[model samples]
Target: MTETIHPTTESANRYLRDNFAPVREELTATDLTVTGRLPDHLDGRYLRIGPNPLDDPGDQHHWFLGEGMVHGVRIRDGHAEWYRNRWVRSAAVADSLGEPHRGTPGERDFAANTNVLEHHGRTLALVEAGAPPYELTHDLDTVGPCDFGGTLPSIPGRPGYAAHPHRDPGTGELHALSYNWTAGNRVAYSVLGNDGRIRRSVDVEVHGSPMMHDFALTERHVVILDLPVTFDIATATEDVPRLVRPLVRGLLNRVIGRNPLPEPVIARIARGGDAVSLPYRWNPDYPARIGIMPRDGDSASVRWFEIAPCYVFHTLNAYDDGDTVVVDVIRHPTMFATVLNGPNEGPAVLTRFTLDLRTGQARETGIDQRSQEFPRHDERLTGRRHRYGWAVGFEDGAPGDTLLRHDLDTGSTESRRLGAGLEASEFCFVPNPDGTAEDDGVLMGYVHDRAEGRSQLRVLDAATLDDVATVHLPGRVPAGFHGNWAPEGADLADV
Candidate 1:
């Protein structure tokens, strides 16, 4: 169960302060206003979920650690039907909102606030921490946690799922590399069939409790990014006692590198790197690695490739060409290198790393020069080579007013700018009805206008980078992590 320690003070973290303040109230209104014409085929809900803590987030208030709330807008037949917002209804959040909690709190509460997607006919709220997903109805209400209709394997200890699971367009199979922080040096790879039943589960070995936020799933292999940023229990200030600092450090040292314990307990006390210092820290001794394990094989089939020490939170796409595997991602120089105040690092640029299986060498190159994050591609082209990538551009770590469309086939990019003082989130491409070309689709997502304090749903033509329409909303929806377009009465397609 989640700890019920009520923080008495407001958070000092940058993410919870200023313009990024959390919205406490939830509302539902019918017949939302539309500023421009919406597409006729755009008949579905546009849902985005992010952290919005209800109460004051005390000392350890990282932006990522706040409670999850989802904002949604429903559009049908070129008309705005309604807009609504609701918290995921976790145990703590339910108690705060005076609603009924739907499921028993596992080792960790279900934040369910990271990303929202429809898979196997179920809409799910997802987070990276070891918590089962909270299901949502088409109207955006919490339907409670799910376990693949009771077909998922019991994780034995702390059960969890990846917030960003990959689906293969060819087979409709969803694959996830689920990791549990409590289970140090261990991770699980699970495959769910098109029927939303667990098909396979394999336990994989790792060095420490590294944060594997995202991975690459190709047709032949699963790319594992085991980086240096590890989970240090000492950072959970509420859990660790003052007298246990030395004991924690000794145990951590042994777990990471198999180092011998120091004979004298109080030989030295360092400023950082000690277990009692930060909730999470960087491990310089750990070599950043990329493992390519066969899609159908076990952990023993993995082939390891070493890369420079860095951190990555997302990957756009990956494909295999002959003996080499090419993966594109947003690369950060370092994360939590010194302190985990927030993402104080420089802008994450779009970079590609190619791993050659025959030679066992990896080379990194720049895909696009612009600083961007939340990269996405046509779902039809996932796990294979195709053109077109879309991402939100960044300025000073905040999403800028432009959406970038990259044409990998032609080695060129086109950008569509939202109005000034407006920022756009990740956009999903909905293919034109019966369209054959990959770029023949409309990109739709949420765009917030800070000056007016309102947000709207924008649909853009994928091939021309032109604005097709904007369905306006009543209030500003906070910028979220990831989202997808769920077209009504249609299967998952590239449009």
Candidate 2:
């Protein structure tokens, strides 16, 4: 029997009410129907992980905080074999499983609900704040917390890892800017070798506990988006005393027959007058600044550049041109600035920042006027100049039924519409083993059709933005954050 979960009045917020609501069923299905020819050489699993809360959150709910559930599909020898979904068993999840937590404790607890990628011959489920990575098999089963085969370095009070670590394709080294929510004013920059051992760790100074979701890598530097979004525990609790506010509201609404307070008032309370918590808030005192540290140097050698206040959740790509650094990113006006459950600002569009090191100035420009999110590109050319970029296109703040492709060389774009009521998730670029061009491979992603109430896996030609194939799924796949293509040999054997 498949269990279905629904949104409750306990939290009358946006994230828990519509497409963002969590699904309750766990399923494993086989031999799904295919709409087009599956490539013969494709042999791997395409997996994605995102937040799915198991317990009641009520009004304190934020999209970034929740238990993680991973959905995957397997393809082999030109056939769609199986699809599976599982919750990452953190200590909290393990308790519900009648087992104990499996890893060393960090300053923050584990959720593993963000991104899944293969590193050092092992697959890892990762989150941003404080948990160590949860290792998994190629088949998507948990293998406990991985300290990189017992070689990843650890600090006394900081134990968090960045979800979007950049792996240098040239040197086979992984680079990450790890930060802890509790450790204010300090962050760590660490590098791991191809052998899965820590190579170097350096502490960088900052103003407050900023939520640095993702950074950018260039040929010579690691660009940091040290913007205004910060962590404030005290303010987060001012509006809604986790225990008292809900009870008071419940009594007034259920027992006294009151209609409850306005959402703006509720939002103000949830923010404690100011948006606070590990979630994130825009800081007015701290000016938005961009810093660049030499990949082979320390924080003391870092150069800082200033920009207008804004929030950036993800960076598409960055490269050095002569004495200036060019970065492409998904730019938002402000994050958590209003009372809405999610971002209340207008749509995020693609923009480029040119940081002139010689003059210490930064200039912003538009790359594409279309509103979009989840920008991605060919990883083989990461930190280097590439010809193409891709993102899930959006109509408003909601997902649009199309995927966009940008040609850097000619400043042209192409859109591949997924029919009328279908929406695509963040997709991965899988390169052809024998292809030479960067855009020669296919783009793979999950698509949900609202009219049919089902989801499917789609494959599109990267060069032309045309549908190549699709595999219909037996169950619903909720929208998610990030994922990667795990090839056949990315396992312990490769290590």
Question: In terms of TM-score, which candidate is strongest?
Answer: 1
Residue-level lDDT tens digits of model 1 in 410-491: 7788887787878888888788777999889888888877766667788888888787888777666776778887767666
CA-lDDT, candidates in order:
0.76, 0.76
The candidate maximizing lDDT is: 2
Error of 1 at 44 (Å): 1.7
Q: How close is every model to the real structure, measured as TM-score?
A: 0.90, 0.87
Candidate 2: pairs in clash: 239-269, 239-272
Show where candidate 2 strays beyond 4 Å: 1-11, 103-107, 150-156, 236-279, 490-495
Off by over 4 Å in 1: 1-12, 153-159, 252-278, 492-495
Candidate 1 at 408: error in angstroms? 1.4
